[model samples]
Target: MFVVSAPSGAGKTSLCRELIDSIPDLRQSISFTTRNIRDGEQDGVDYFFTQTDSFQRMIAEQLLAEYAEVHGNYYGTSLETLNTAEAEGVDLLLDIDCQGAAQLKKNYRRGVFIFILPPDFAELKKRLYNRGTDHEDVIQRRLENAEQELLQAPWYDYLVINDDFQSAKKKLMAIITAERCRMSRTTYLLNNFTVKGDK
Candidate 1:
């Protein structure tokens, strides 16, 4: 499993979409949330929209692998989703926030955690304002949250900065490719190439 996390307006979603589309066997784990759906967002697609009570119940039942409340709403990934992907030998890509990623890492030892950041604080602020989706107060809150999130970069397995879209995408793709090609996972290929007349 791979966890890709970043603050709002950091281009994580766009990068994730490109990664999923490009990778042949990658599956994105859809998260469930109690947050209200924003414009153009659909239930079961953007998120498995549910109520706070239901979310809490799932947590109590230990059905969720990790859960957290953000911006006054709850969000989590179901264990069933993770297990299904693992059973099928599919790479699971989780696009979650830093807190959720940390929670997942605690339980899943083999997960690859990648934290994406914007080019710089100035650019990050500009991107947030350009989105025009939040009021000044809300934007300020997001900026504050972003600063904290950025500080957690060292906790991730890899840190990717969105300085250039294509360059960052290439770096992300290379990382996934390199991981898949690890010696332990690709031993079969090595065995197939041995010389027939070898001792």
Candidate 2:
């Protein structure tokens, strides 16, 4: 599994979309959220929109691998989805916030953790304004939150600075490719090899 986290207005979402579309077998892990569905978002595709009661039940049942409350809404990843992906030998890409990513780290350490940063604070602020999805106060809050989230970058395995869209996309793709090609992960190939030297 690949867990990616970025501050608001950062390009992690767009970058992840590029990866899943271009790479066969790389599936996105659509999370469950209590937030209302936004324009252009589809249920079960972007997120599994649920009632707060149902979301609380998932937490009570321990069905969620990791969960967090962001912007007064609950977001979570289901352990069932993760288990099914692993059983099917398919990779999963998770686009979540730092809060959720931290919880996932304790539960699933094998995932590749990637942190996305904007080119600079000025650029981040500009992006937030251009998004026009949040209110002025909400945008300021996100800026404040971005400062805190940036501090968590060192904890991730990869730090990707999203200066240029295509460049950042290529870098993420490279990271995923390298992780998938790790010798330990591809040891299944050894089963087909007949070696002359024995350990």
Best by TM-score: 2
The weakest ten consecutive residues by lDDT in model 1 span: 190-199
**How many Å off is the CA of 128 in candidate 2?**
0.8
Pairs of residues at least 3 apart in sequence or in different chains that clash in candidate 2:
none
Quote the lDDT for 171 in model 1: 87
Model 2, 34-124: lDDT tens digits are: 9999899999999999999999999999999999998799999999989989999899999988888988888776889999989899999
- TM-score per candidate: 0.93, 0.94
Candidate 1 local lDDT, residue 148: 87
lDDT, candidates in the order shown: 0.90, 0.92
Number of the top lDDT candidate:
2
**89-133, model 1: which lDDT tens digit per residue?**
999999998889889889878888999989889998999999998
